[model samples]
Target: MSAQIKNGTILLAEPFMLDPNFKRSTVLVVEHNPEGSLGFIMNRRVNMRVDALAKEFPEFDAPVYFGGPVGTDTVHYLHRKGDLLEGSDEVMEGIFWGGNYEKLRFLIDQKLITPYDIRFFVGYSGWSDSQLQEELEGGSWVTARMDPNYLFKSDPEKLWSQVMENKGDTFSVIASMREEPSYN
Candidate 1:
């Protein structure tokens, strides 16, 4: 595995990847170790809200996202409230993943955590030992530095292309290609 790829790294699926679950997806690495790697697909938003997933969840407008193809029965979260949310693991400088669930609900109830301050996800992207290394070596993914704004300030709809373009050089050109090109 490249030293650059680690916890909090951003993995951009190669533009032509064929996997339905990851094609054009922007993934945020939450953990990477000798055992394996795990991340959340940052760009695959689902047409639902967090409140719809559980009866106990407070009524909120936070959109739910398809984190990846693994653990569909689970729910996870990323937030910018590292200072205020207890038990949050910092994925990067200003981004935190997972925290006290009851505290989260309480914060939401008090309007202390806004939808813009957090994102809810279902499932997660994961790889077995050396699986992610093999995938990275095979050119299936491109790495980028994580920026908190990408999650809290930017639009998920354009995250893949936006990150690709930000990489500059050949990546900028790749970012400009149409998702489905037609050669006439």
Candidate 2:
């Protein structure tokens, strides 16, 4: 509760969290305000792709991320193609979420935006006003500074622990723990 949460902060799930949707999840907070907060789970890559779901979309091959349990019917995206994608809102330094959809297709078709420059999500994680604050108070998450490069550059399977490891010291120790500790 005392931590200063803001857009671009990485929300790391606490070790051994029980929520199946969020255990070992790493989320990028895209919006924060009195109304609520919204973000996409950065580490969960679903077994699907953009063009697979929408044949109309150009033949773009890339991993489709599972943003969260909310709004599975819709698609959302995060990217670093600020001006190239146009009308994008900066979630933080170097990271931008959303823009003109038509322009996105055009950029994808023209090869102006590469897979390295963006990530698509099936849905997003949302928190309502006091809900996030309550979660923070309840020890469900740990906040860390974001290095936007980590989004596209880091291995998704290791993201949660990798990010936690980057925080150093005790966090590194925690990161070394197996996800299913009982097996050990």
Each model's lDDT comes to 0.92, 0.90
Off by over 4 Å in 1: 1-3
Model 2 lDDT per residue over 34-121, tens place: 9999999999998988889765799898889999999988888899988787789999889999999999989999999888988999
Q: For residue 79, what is the lDDT in candidate 1?
A: 96
Which residue pairs clash in candidate 1?
none
Measure candidate 1: CA RMSD: 1.4
Give one digit per residue, the lDDT tens place, for model 1 in 1-184. Answer: 5646789899999888999999999999999888999999999999999999967988899999999999999999999998989999998888999999899999999999999999989999999998888898899999999899998888899999999999999999999888875631
Q: What are the runs in model 2 whose C-alpha is more than 4 Å off? A: none
Candidate 2: lDDT of 15? 92
